[model samples]
Target: MYGEGDNQVKALDEVSLSVNQGEFVLIVGSSGSGKSTLLNMIGLLDRPTNGTIKIDGVNTTTLNDDKISAFRNTKLGFIFQFSNLLTDLTVLENVLLPRQIGGTTKTANKDATDLLKAVGLESQINKRANKISGGQAQRAAIARGLVNKPSIVLADEPTGNLDSVTSETIVQLMKSMAKRLGQTFVIVTHDRQHFGEVDKVITIKDGKAFEGEDDPSTASGKEMEVVA
Candidate 1:
């Protein structure tokens, strides 16, 4: 909600959905459809005016700012459309940034290395972020997002900046990694091709959410009950 009186607006109106552990969920909607808002809510970046968000069985709505920040740092991971890596830092260093901020650097070195290797960025580990290609940079970003071993990883149009082939590759890599690590992924993307790979597809319209079917093509017509 924003503004007052005549200018008041509800960004999200009773939007509800559930994401099971180890599930690959895709969120699709047009611009200004509240897709990002829902993601922000699930990522704990923003709190709702009403209702509760339970992640890994923890009710985040009741946490104070300090506790929320700590919980977010430890339980939530994010991958954006842009890699947003530090240009001056090496790939390895960028991946370890979260751990450094969280004061958990003891085993982070090895964990970061392993994540980079998993994402096929091991060869570029020592290279400066500015020197890597867009795909490599995004891969590094993926590695960075998983460095903390967060409960769920939230990605916003991760393949939006890549070519079709690169986009397919990136999605496959994400899916494979998710399967191997048993990590849950909630991604917001415009690419319909990704629907085939995800465990669930959520469509957001006018601040409302609806669950889709298993088959991507037939998902639009079939809607499931929204879970609060």
Candidate 2:
């Protein structure tokens, strides 16, 4: 809901869904279909006008702002389209930033290094963020997102700024890392090709959510099958 009375627009209407532990869930929708809103809701970045969001059995809507922020820092990780790294920071430092903020830097150095290695950015760990290529920076961002070992990771068009090849690589890296670390991932992407290996596919339309694939006889369904 964005406004009052006639100006009100319901970005999401009765949209309900769930992701199991270690599940890789993909959310897709055409423009203005409210997929991002759904992600924001699930990510605890936005509170719903009417409804509840439970992450790791905690009802987020019930928490105060301070508690919400604390919970978010500890339980959720995020990767955006852009790497959003500080130019002056090295890849390793950038990845350790979150741990430092959370006061959990005791083993952060080792954890960050291992995550960068997993994302194939071990060689670039000492490079300043500004010196890295777009793909390498995004890989570093992935490492940063996983540094805290959060329960769930939320990514919004994480590969939107990359080329097709890099996009594919990033997606695969995320999937593999999720499986290896047993972390749940909820991604909002426009790339249909990602449908191939996900545990679940959720489509958003007219502010409503429809889970699973469409009818096989439908054109979109056929396309999904071919992509998968």
Q: Once model 1 is optimally superposed onto the true structure by TM-score, how far is the C-alpha of residue 132 displaced, in angstroms?
A: 0.6
What tens-digit string does per-residue lDDT give for candidate 1 at 1-228?
756999987888877687889999998878888889889999888889888888888888999999998998999899999999999999999999999999998999999999999999889999999999999999999999999999899999999999988888889999998999899999998886754756888887777777874233555644444432
Q: Total clashes, candidate 1?
A: 0
Q: Could you tell me the TM-score of candidate 1?
A: 0.93
Please give the clash total of every predicted structure, in order.
Answer: 0, 0
Query: TM-scores of all models?
Result: 0.93, 0.92
Candidate 1: minimum summed lDDT over ten consecutive residues — where?
219-228
The candidate that wins on TM-score is: 1
- RMSD for each of the candidates: 2.4, 4.5
lDDT of 2 by residue, 144-183 (tens): 9999899999999998899999998999999889989999
Q: How far is candidate 1 from the true structure (C-alpha RMSD, Å)?
A: 2.4
Model 2: residue 54 alpha-carbon error in angstroms? 0.5
Which candidate has the top score in lDDT?
Answer: 1
